[model samples]
Target: MRVGGSEYQFTGTQSHPYWFGWESMTTENPSVVLQWKSEGTGEQHQQNYPVILQVGGGLLHIWYISPGEVWNKVGTAPFSARAWHKVELGIFARPDTTGWFQVYVDGQLVADARNARTWDDRGNKPRWGVYDSKIATADQTHWINGLKLGTSRADVD
Candidate 1:
């Protein structure tokens, strides 16, 4: 399955390291945001996709994916998975030099790297999102709703 005019593939083992189970999108915009909730279980993991960016642009896009706990990596309240969990993935482009990128889930900052290792980090600009296609247990699948894309604060708000 595909979304946001982006293309992604599950290139890892589906049973080990929990296999990156998530979604991937190819957008021409500088930045975007996505919100999702568990469809069946409680906490779940959503992996980020690889993107490429032009070094001259100095622009960064963030991929945010949750306000609730991310599978088991986040949260302390022990939220319920049967219910809906809200997540927002933001992609940000660095300043003038265009050397690094960032990935944020919910409202918490995740990472800023010169070389990202999400799937295949090709450094492709204007293309960022989630891509988790790992089929583990009988009741395992990454699902999220309420996805939105915004360039800046105003566009998202």
Candidate 2:
């Protein structure tokens, strides 16, 4: 799916924050599966994981910026093009150090990371989509289905 040209299925406002989906990319190029920004003054982008599927470079990078910018790659695995994969992300509505995040592909725990804070001060939510970052190639496309959000994991699974 085109990122900038299309609207996301869910715009996680304060009222709704949980995000999850099943996606398949035709290209091994880097692309954003999901992203959330703080509603603070700068809209400080809190978290997003861009799936790196390049051969010998398969990694799930959890991007975050608190005191400083950092990309945490908690999992690594080569991704096959056009293969369906699952992803789930949970965040607290309010900013606190007790927030957590996890990643799963093909029902396997690829990356599991936790922290005291999942979001920054102010309300936080999700902008779920296959963001064509064009890091490897311009104008990339991805397929997404079973997109969901809920209070529990089962709700999205």
The per-model lDDT (C-alpha) reads 0.29, 0.52
List pairs with backbone clashes in candidate 2. 1-142, 97-116, 97-117, 98-116
Candidate of highest lDDT: 2
Clashes of 1: 42
Residue 140 in candidate 2, Cα distance off native in Å = 0.5
> Looking at model 2, which ten-residue stretch has the lowest summed lDDT?
47-56
User: 87 in model 1: Cα distance from truth in Å?
Assistant: 3.1
Q: Model 1, 1-68: lDDT tens per residue?
A: 34456653322222221111222222222222222221223232223323321111122233322223
Q: What ranges in model 1 sit over 4 Å off?
A: 1-83, 92-99, 114-137
Question: What shift in Å separates residue 113 of candidate 1 from its native position after superposition?
Answer: 3.4
Model 2 residue runs over 4 Å out of place are 1-19, 40-56, 130-137
lDDT of 2: 0.52
Candidate 1 local distance difference test against the native? 0.29
